[model samples]
Target: MAEKASESSNSISLNTVDGKIFKVSPTIANQMQTIQSLIKAYDSSRVISLPHVNAFHLSKIIEYLEGKSATTVSAVKEFEAQFMKDLSLKQLKGLLIAVGYLKVNELLELMPKTVAKLIENKSVEFLRKFFGIVNDFTPSEEAKIREEIAWAFDGVDED
Candidate 1:
């Protein structure tokens, strides 16, 4: 029991691309596939470096991993709702990529689904802004594209 408690208390250091270091328990770190693989490959005492993940995304991913194992279904649902509500589209996209790379399946599924909900009933302009995608089409080309997908523009939110 003491060994189990100590194991739970044991922390691993994660080094992000922005030179930020975060210490998390082995339990939380194991949620990320990349980190799990690294832990297996190297000594747990070593600080794992994630060159592609930024601090913001890493922290959020850690937050999700730490929160996801709640005993109650309602608590997890509430936490997940707030977590999704708190992130902006840009943050969501960044997190999606980071989670995808980390292979955090729950977060990988959640972020994209949240993004899809945000995009649902939104305009082309809204999508372009949300995704940081450039609208390079000529007026006529855009018109044709819109015409082809007229249903997408219907029932869109004004905001």
Candidate 2:
């Protein structure tokens, strides 16, 4: 009986990369499918490790998870808008990918808006550099990508 009780009780701790342990509920853990499967599949009761997610990002994700669960929808949206404003493009991309994987709706909604602002009114060179996209295409292909999004690229300075 004690073994069974201990087993059930041990499943909720999430180990982040910076050595922080997040004692989350199984139901909340289930909200992250990646975490849910790892928990369900693992035999041990020790903390589940999240290597890809660093401490800062993990803490933010936790805040997002807890915030959404506790707050009103409008409040969550407002917070997300403010939150994305402070994050760098690299952090934004990471957050976008993480939030996308976690299936958190508010963060997911903010990603496109953030990306649009970063790329809007910028040159192709800026877009390429911002996204770390190498110019694999030939000059013809470059012309094509630009011609394809003429409206999106219109009125932009040469880059």
For residue 69, model 2's alpha carbon misses the true position, in angstroms, by 1.7
For model 2, the superposed segments whose C-alpha errors exceed 4 Å read 1-11, 101-106, 144-152, 157-159
Q: For residue 79, what is the lDDT in candidate 1?
A: 93
Predicted candidate 2 versus true structure: per-residue lDDT over 1-159, tens digit per residue? 111122456447777667767776675677777777777788646678877666667667766666677779779877767777778878877776676666655556657887987777788688887777898899998898778877775588665
Error of 2 at 96 (Å): 2.1
What C-alpha lDDT do the candidate models reach, one value each? 0.81, 0.70
Measured by lDDT, the strongest candidate is 1
**lDDT of candidate 2?**
0.70
lDDT of the structure predicted as candidate 1: 0.81
- Give the per-residue lDDT of model 1 (tens digit) for 35-85: 899999999988889998998898888777777775477798889999999
User: What TM-score do all the candidates reach, one by one?
Assistant: 0.76, 0.71
Stretches > 4 Å off in candidate 1: 1-10, 134-142
Candidate 1, residue 146: lDDT: 84
Q: Write down the RMSD of all candidates, one decimal each.
A: 4.5, 5.7
